[model samples]
Target chain A: MDTLNKIINWFTDGSSNKLSYHYFSRKFTPMAFIGPALLVMAILLVFPLLFSFKLSFQQWHMIEQASPFWIGLDNYFELLANKQFWNSFGLQLLFVVVAVSFELLIGLLVAVLLNREFPGNKIIRALLLLPIFILPVVSGLTFRFMYNPQYGAINYFLKLIGFNSIAWLSHPETAFAAIIIQDIWRMWPFMFMILFAGLSSLPEEPYEAAIIDGASRWRTFLHITLPLLKPTIMTAIILRTVDALKAFSEIFVMTSGGPGNATTLLSVHIYKSAFKFWELGYSAASSYMLVFIAMIFTVLLVRNMFSE
Target chain B: MHKFKSWSRWKKGLFFLTVFIILFVELFPIFMVVTTSFKPKLQIWTSKSPFELFRPTFKNYLQVFKDRNFAKYIKNSLIIASITTFIALFLGSLAAYGFARFKFRGNFLLSMGVLASRMIPPITLSVPIFILISEWKLLDTYFSMILAHISFSLPYVIWLLLPFFKGIPASYEEAAMLDGCSRQRVFFSIFLPLVAPGLVVAAIFTFMLSWNDFLYALVLTSSRAKTAPLAVSEFIGQFAPEWGMMTAAGTVFLIPVFIFALGLQKYIIHGLAFGGDK
Candidate 1:
């Protein structure tokens, strides 16, 4: 028994084994499979993100034609003082509030109904999913034409119902509203998919028991379905909020953050700072701030998810 | 009893009403685009007729092809999206398998780290990534967008497939191993075949994500790497986005996505609705 224990200990000890060819191969296999992907994600994604985070502390403009001067926290201070930054920040918040709220309400409705085996459900669902596949830029381009005041589909439809065109993307307040509305058109389908899954996966026993107890359908839905689907609701909100916060391409195409920064979210601000005006340091700082905000929401969401 | 019956009837009526309105709102915009695409150039700007097809012509579709070699854009979108879907699903699956099967240090952190990378806003990374591409001097190249799309979509593959892989029976692979098949061989023969439905879903989704991406294409590529959306965005400038041309382009743009969505609708719908096939 002692000798047997000694043999086991000998194999277990790494210093004794010197990693035999068999051991080498066993340990080596993982790196061979996972190494390349990790490297790519690290270099292209992780490294650039870290580099940007570091650069956020520096003061640099592309116009300077020199290395970025390290200016700690001043860029953040500059952003705090900039009223335009605050306004755009307000607009982004408003955009998320409006977009997420509408998508959730409409999406839940759609998912509840679509969950039942109805006529043409598959085709309707497919059509619904179509917008998800349409590139955001293309959605913007298509809707941009649709929002055309004189000759677009949206105006034509409104005119058909006897209302005049509504400067959907041109007017400042309406510009932000227009982007939110269009975003809802694209986003609800995704929310629908998530909620549909949640609803479908809901055990029917509680629902059946409620029905047997003479509880009304609405009561059952409110008490049973809604409570059961809460996790799904939370997931959708978190994911959609993350996306709505980062909304760029559509806003870039639709408003260009225009009519005096009406729709400029953090993203467009970051873009203009970095590329358009070439304020690399300030943009990097702004980018870090955005990441910080996104990470906070994400952590809250993930914790909420796992806890439940 | 009568009051309860009335309320039930009213609730059913409200349900149908909700579905109807949602369907109309969700689908009508796409319907409008489709109908407008067929309108005559003379009436595209002038006609307010939503239902009338009086001047229906293939003129817009013809213009899409003849005017700009839009066929090339279409071809490019197909090639780029297909390549991305294939490579991402393949490589991502291998990596997921490694992470799932191997007892390595930091595997959970590494796998979850994949999710973290995804959670980072693409907009946050775009400028630097574009700079990296430009420095690599790969600007206006399909390679850049392809690489960029792979980063985001690959994680999705890993995330989606990990759940599927975890649920699947590993005993079959173990059995095959006892039959003298290598781990890689058993993986191909047993694991890959078993999870095909899930893979179909992943392929369709990865394809859509890559196809739908715009910013990388916008910033990374000038002309050479212009995907379909980039091709469409090009028409719009300081002025109005050339309505007839925009209509023509948008219609052409919707077809491939529509076809793919229709084709993979089942796999994707199932995967998305329940997380994965398993």
Candidate 2:
């Protein structure tokens, strides 16, 4: 930290030494720069995270309401060995992978389609964005009602086409599937927006060159369009994966991590452990673990994106 | 590689159809919500008959606005989002200017740390925030939620502002300095105007994140300070979840966000991805 301060001070001195760049020589006020942000962020977030960190070391289940035993690492030890915790973590991992992949593919296809110079494409593009704005809480509950066997739109549509209603939310396999499908629907619009932005921004030079080379449309897209879109595609995937791993509002609104905890991802699990079950310490530990997983994926995403 | 004008008529029709089908699927859920909002209460609950709207009434909407606290919820959301955006932007821009114009120590770590804060799932932090508010005796107050939201929005603000600051040529600031303008004067007159557009986009994205926030509001505030999404979620409870009331609330909540997005969709498209991969 001293080295850092010295390095910064050196830059300040050098710039001030030059009469042309002396405005920043305001008598060394470090507080003015990082102050407001620090105050806001510290009171709201950093303090809270640290608060949760210390709270996690104590026991807070039914044993204590206001005060707890300072059982260092006990909660984490139990959580680490807990079968249910690992299972839910595994579920979240799977959900993030599958959901992000599907969203990226569908979103890319929509972007490609929207990128075309069609007559009614503007209206389609506008309409395509409707889902991205819909609040996840409402979407989740609406789907809960929609997936209702007796009154759901899905079952109703199925019967109209002479098909039986699939037990959409109650059954284990279908419940998770239903949430994934709903998430895809909710998320694809934003993905579409990003991918479309990328496609639109691409210079026509590469495609033009490919055309002169007698490359087929498929070949040009594969060799040129896809390669050029690498960054945007990574952006969409990273954004989707992070959100998917933290999928809470929808699942909380819809399933509440129920039907024997089959749909309880790590986040919902954290919610249950902390708020619903009143185990603050255990929940805090679980949340940090959750943060660890998210960071891992995020780092991997950054690495992959930069690698290309 | 070929222009669409050279395509055969049959192929053109196929492409059009393909586009339509994809858009239809993409839009089906939103379409359902809009259409359902207009349908009468009984028609929605009784899934016995679908695709048929026997009666239409504004009663559900009327109830949403009049029966419950939809109006209060909207007012709360608007106030919180607006204040958060303003305060955050004011502070964020100043800090960004400071970091950009001034040479700083631990700048790299601090910047990376700020960005890293955003990567953590919000759910993880809610517990700590809840505890903090409780400790500070701020629970159930607008301040609690607003403060909580600032933490979430700040990282994005810094990240967004950093690039715009970097993009501004340093010669301009140097010139201002040479002209006997103080550092603060240069920031206000010279740099602030240049970064205003980027600031607007940053504010919009931050405001939306706060307005659309559910978890913080859900855990941090009770009924007195509840936002629209939180109020909307209340329609579902342990027993006898009121479908009509919920859908009514949902529609009202959706309308403001939808209208805001529709009006500013272009701004959103251009601006929200400020810190995003360029």
Candidate 3:
């Protein structure tokens, strides 16, 4: 009892043992601040991740109501063999590459154009940012309405232009292109916002030097701005790429991966597998594959971000 | 600055024209939705030109509020988002402050862990989360939805706020400590208030994320806790098209965020500058 009391005193009695107390608080303070968030992450994120990882190796159908039986690599083997899985994987790659490329190019152009002093530039930038905050579900619904074959605003404009109205979301190729267009419209501003911020902060010395050397504006931009903006560009692209891979609500609301699976990205495929087909284990396996793909970019992103 | 004055009349006209075209294209869809909300049903279907002017009606908004139980969904979304924002801000700021101020072992790894967690696709976790929520019999509960939201929002809040905390000079805290203030008091009265602008930005962004969330709400809540986004999506699943009510609901759902984004544009821009860089 005496020993226990002394040990407790050693911890609590700051005045008696100032050195120990100082060392203890230094270690304890950060943990006190950080521990709760770490605990929450472990419970909500880490645990579920491990649980899903375990489920990937088992065979379980939600509708069957049986226990998840150990299937060992069978689910992975089936996923590898599934034609739809490969198709979705290919589509996922195509979607991310195409959408991100257009967004980067267009976003950089707009940012460069608007980086100059202009009237109403602030309002225009703010207005451009509105789409980023609007709910994806709402955007999807609006785009769907705008793509309606009979009454949509888009087809109406096509008619005004003397072109035949396209059934935008009803056909396979058009459906894919339609979603990509909507995504670009919705996301380009993100790149613009980041690149615009980067552009605004760039040192004026480079432009001044380039002007003294009589370098053309285009050449100066390619040589000076591109190199300086590389970090911000990399950050924006990787962030968008990871987010684009997880694009679900917009696509789900727009086409529901429809026109006969023409637009099924990996995320949508996993969703349909779990909910529509009730293949829980299979979906878990597919989701891990998605995590794998995202992690590659995420690793590069983190390294790129922290390297400086 | 002289470049503008040096430009020819045609070049100046072209510049303004380009700006006008960009604005019009970007905002047209939003304009369509907002205007469609005010259009009478007959006008919506019969109007040949999307830009045609007409007398606006409040009937769609009236019906959405009276019949569709949209009020409940909005209430759920408000309750869940507000609570999640509050809790996330509290916990996330503390963690961010720790990561910024302390040079303890594994700080970099832990901070990176939080960043990496933020990048985890929510869809990837939806399956296990759904099963877990159901197992705990938490489906359709506000608790379940808020938990799921906080899981995503907390990491983001931490990531966003870390740079803000790091930007503050250490002398402030040291000065306070020497002035007989306890560490807790110093953090609350000094650090938090100093980071108030950051807190505001974090609050708005976190609230916006929670408010706009769809997947977690979809998986975790069936009816009682269904969010505004989910309810808006449900408008399309019905047999008959309800564009008027859908647009009205969407407008209501988005108006608060639009106001936040525009009204707080300065702070958001500052936040984005930091958000993009680090």
Candidate 4:
């Protein structure tokens, strides 16, 4: 009873105890704020990550109803020897490069065009954002409908222009190109939004000096705008690249990685392995490879973003 | 503005023409989907021209609602997305405020952890999450789906709201604390209202993330908690080119997103641009 009374007095003594109270609260307040998010992250993210790593080293056929047995690095070795895996990896690289390139180029051009004052600019810019929000499944379905060789809009327009109708998704090359086009159509606005913002926020002093020096518009853009916008461009590229690597819903809806495995992106490959083949262990390994690739880009992004 | 006025007549015409072309290309597919949603089955299948005039019909929508169980899926989507968005916003804003204001030991490392977690591919997480959810017998339930959705949305919310909190002047809180107000009071009354735009952006994004999710819903839920995107994708596989119904369903799925994009255009742009900077 005496000890309890002394402890209470030590804490509640207003003049002498205020510093300790403040110190304890200061140390705890942030934890109270951040603890829930960290808990969720741990349960959902970190746990899954560690579990996946463990699963990658085991052999678990989900359909077998047998316990998973340790298989060492067999999955990784199998992945190395797997032609289909490499094919999917190559296709993913191609998709990322082509889709991001077209999006970046077109997005930059449009951002430059819209950066200036114009009639109905606000409405056009708002409309530009519509594509970004369209569900990927919807985009894929709409594009598939349009790309139908018979009675489709794209074919109809092609016939109008005196060009013969062509099957878009039935063949491998066209299917790859078609998916890339769909992706570019859906994603360019993201790039445009960022680049446009960067353009608008650019300092005017360089342009003012360029005008005084009689530099041509193209010269001014090359010298002034591009350099200043490098950070934004880097940010946009890294973000889009990571997202494109994860592209699944639309392509899955469109082709399901069909046409003799022509459009099997790494994500589609991972999905097929897990769900279709029920090779849970192998799928976990391949997904980790995808994560490894994504992590490199993420590391670059974090460094680029936080270095300043 | 001066440049536009000083341009030659032909240059000005060319500029407008360029803008028109870009808009036409970008918006054409959206226009096609919207118009096709209104077209009759016969018109959609046997149209002579892409621009052929026809009377609009809601028969496809009627079929989608009457035949397909889109309403239930949409209900599931709404409930799951709303819950995830609410919880994510509350938790994310608190953590973002901590990272922005508090001088903690792992502040930098923890913020980086949040950023790195944001980059984790969902497919990678799907396998373990599926196993764990099923092991716990939580599969096909809204609880499982909501938890999975929060895995991604929480990080995004934190990443986005961090800058908003940091942008607030520290003096505002300092002054509030100097008064009789407590820290919690200052946060609720002064800080949250000031960051209302950021909160709105985070809510919209988190909602959209949950609403548009397909993979986790695919793996996590078999039927009961299936979302609209998964349901809509299933439409394609069930039949042979049901273009009218597909377009109608697609259009319906897009309506909420369209409302969000158009209504809150300013704040989204600000968020995207500001987020891109960091």
Best by DockQ: 4
Evaluate residue B171 in candidate 4 and report its C-alpha lDDT on the 0 to 100 scale: 90
Query: After best superposition, candidate 3 residue A14: deviation in angstroms?
Result: 8.1
| Interface RMSD after interface superposition, model 4 | 3.6
Model 3 CA lDDT for position B162 = 93
> Which residue pairs overlap in candidate 1's backbone?
none
Alpha-carbon RMSD, each predicted model: 6.0, 4.4, 3.5, 3.9
* Candidates sorted on lDDT, descending: 3, 4, 2, 1
Q: What lDDT does candidate 2 reach at residue B156?
A: 73
Q: Predict model 3's lDDT versus the native.
A: 0.87
Candidate-wise lDDT, in order = 0.75, 0.78, 0.87, 0.86
User: Per candidate, chain B TM-score?
Assistant: 0.87, 0.90, 0.95, 0.95
A best-first ranking of the candidates according to their TM-score comes to 3, 4, 2, 1
The top-ranked prediction according to lDDT is 3
lDDT by residue (A1-308, candidate 3, tens digit) is: 35533433343332324575477667776776788789899999999999999999998898886679989999999999999999999999999999999999999999988887667878889999888877999999899999988889999989998999999998999999999999999999989998988888899898899999999988998999999999999989998998898799989989999899999999899999998898999999999999899889879988897887
Q: For model 4, how does the per-residue alpha-carbon lDDT over A195-250 read when each residue is reduced to its tens digit? A: 99888989988888998999998998898899999898999999999889879989
- Candidate 3 error regions (>4 Å): A1-17
Specify the CAPRI tier of model 3. medium
Show the lowest summed lDDT stretch of 10 residues, model 4 chain B: B177-186
The pairs that clash in candidate 3 are none
Per-residue lDDT of candidate 2, residues A1-308 (tens digit): 35534544454443435553444455454445567677778777788889889988988764357676689999999898999899899889888888888888888887876676767766677777777777888889888878889888888778989999987888888898888988988888778888888888899788778868999978888989998988778877886777787688889898888778889999999988888888999999999998898787667655764676
The ten-residue window of minimal lDDT in model 3 chain B covers: B269-278
